[model samples]
Target: MDGKKALYYAAIAIAVLIGVGIVISVISALVTLVSTVISAAISLAVLAGIVYVAYKAGSWLLGSDDSPSMDSIGSGSSTSVDAGTSRQDRLRQQYVEGQISEAEFERRIGEELETEEIDDIDRELERER
Candidate 1:
């Protein structure tokens, strides 16, 4: 009867030890998962920051200067040939001065022509109305 009692106590102790080990293992796994998630988040944030900085730097480096606004294209101040000079002339000057690429100059000229046309059409519509 005493031996039976000893065996029953040993069984309970083993069961308790196993339960504690399982709990510790589960806790460890959860901690590892959390750490991994945090690491990945930090890495992604750093990458995003780098990309943003690069984008800003590229824009600053490649941005044009003092170019005429689209809104000024069809205005009286923009279309004058002598004092203000036409937008096309300004774009050509910029191209000649190496401030803008030939392609950019051509594109801006096309835009100016389109804006002028649109403005004329709008004026005609207003007159009709």
Candidate 2:
């Protein structure tokens, strides 16, 4: 839950506990001792549980996660790769758009012309280990 809601609930719980204590103390003066003690004990336990849960929810709201995930640490994009373009087509467009000189385009295109099949680099490292 959010900070405001958590605090509100905590305040409500405190109010309820205080109300119960007052009622019990008033009744104890007029009634038997045993019932008053039992009601006070139950109220205390309930109040403690509420406080613990509220504290935990507040911590979560405050973003106190000790470990971070990859998605939270890195950025990525949503654009999908186009299926219609050949590698040559993309190179042609890059040149037409004036993003790269013809010489640089040709050089990069040539470099990418002979790519080998990719294997699992992680698995290879593990094998060596």
Q: Say which candidate scores most in TM-score.
A: 1
lDDT score at residue 76, model 2, on the 0-100 scale:
20
lDDT of 2 by residue, 32-129 (tens): 66778889999999999999889877877797744443444542221111211255578888899999999988897775553311223444575799
lDDT of 1 at 14: 99
Per-residue lDDT value at 101 in model 1: 93
Report model 1's TM-score to 2 decimal places: 0.49
lDDT of 1: 0.80
lDDT winner: 1
**Candidate 2 TM-score, C-alpha based:** 0.29
| Residue 109 displacement (Å), model 2 | 44
Off by over 4 Å in 1: 64-129
All candidates' TM-scores?
Answer: 0.49, 0.29
- Cα deviation in Å at residue 52, candidate 1? 0.7
